[model samples]
Target: MGFLQRLGSAFSAIIAFLVGVITLVSLLLGGNPGLFGDLPQAADLAALLALPAAVLLRLVALVIALGVLIGIANLLLTHAQRLMRGRALSAALLGSFALTLFWYVARAGDTSLLEAVQLPIESSLAALLCLTLVGGAARVIAKRADIWSLLFVLSLLIVLLASLPWAELEPLRAWRDWLLRVPVSAGTRALLLGIALATVVAGVRIALGQDRAYRG
Candidate 1:
């Protein structure tokens, strides 16, 4: 946790430094887009500066890199608090962290993680299927009527149906896609509004120091 916190802070610093440099260059050369600076007329200024369109694309990459750095900061804050509170490590948390970190290191045509680790798309689906089977079987063997196990069984049923190449599921898949494309898009568009409302309520509650998710 200490290592992760430091790593996150260091990454944030690097991103900030790069952003500052690019912004300075963009303002200075006013067009070259040096390293990560965005200079639209860079080509027009190419003869004056002698660069290419490919160099301009670095600005977009820098923007994306900054976003990733911020995401790591968020994760560091969340996990550091969890660690300080002595929270037990859960399978979901560990698995998600591992997968995210692995994928982050496996991008840009570097599929080494996919080849050497469990980051492949096919592997993920297979793992999900195995988990569903194991969960259902364990519940049945234990003679327990767990809601979680039941939900897994129900989802597996749907997956099994979907996995089959049947005409019935064709329309179902189309409808599912449409549902996600419509309501999901609307929800995403309005997500900040919902977050603002929730933040206000939570802020009032925490004004009295009633929130302890970050408390050590």
Candidate 2:
């Protein structure tokens, strides 16, 4: 049994490696004939290379849709069980879900209900988030009292004040714009690059059969 399992794992790893490589190459070199130089039928070769990635992407989208449906069904089932146990929160959740679903179907895809209900909820959450950030910054400054902490608090204060409509905040608004345009943009890009690198590393591990989840 152990030997059979090892063999199955090896087969799966080989298949995964080949598929990953094909998809990566197709996506990288598929659309640009210039990458292939002046070779004969370069465009045709590029098209052929692109086909596999396109088909695989469509399959991935279909799988994602199916997964979403499965998730919704599971949520409903779990919440329904809780509702049977007299959980008011679960009952509210299920009620809201049913109402939203019914509204969507009944209105022939009208989303006015969502705009009226969801938008205010989202705005309120955003306001709460701003307050949470301010509170956290204060706590950090109180506990640490370091240069970085002070800078963080000052930056937060400036940004918050800049958001006000008062004429006294006009100068701070320029500073806020510069902070957002330069440092914030750079930090955001750095985070995105890091995430991309991490994703690539994970993909490489999976492709190389080093990921433990694929051992089965």
Predicted structure with the largest TM-score when compared to the true one: 2
**Clash count per candidate:** 1, 0
Looking at candidate 1, the ten consecutive residues that score lowest on lDDT are 207-216
Regions of model 1 farther than 4 Å from truth: 1-57, 90-116, 120-122, 126-216
- Per residue, candidate 2 scores C-alpha lDDT tens digits across 1-216 of 699988987788888888788888889889788988999999999999899999999999999999999999999999999988988799888888989999999989999988999999999999999889778877997899999888888878888899999998899999999999999899899999999999999987775567746553
TM per candidate: 0.26, 0.84
Error of 2 at 85 (Å): 2.6
lDDT of each: 0.62, 0.88
lDDT of 1 by residue, 1-216 (tens): 699987876666565455445544444454443543475765566344433323655766898999999998788678767866887564456566667677777775565655665557677898899889777677664785688667655544554556678887986667556655786578776997899999877754443334423333
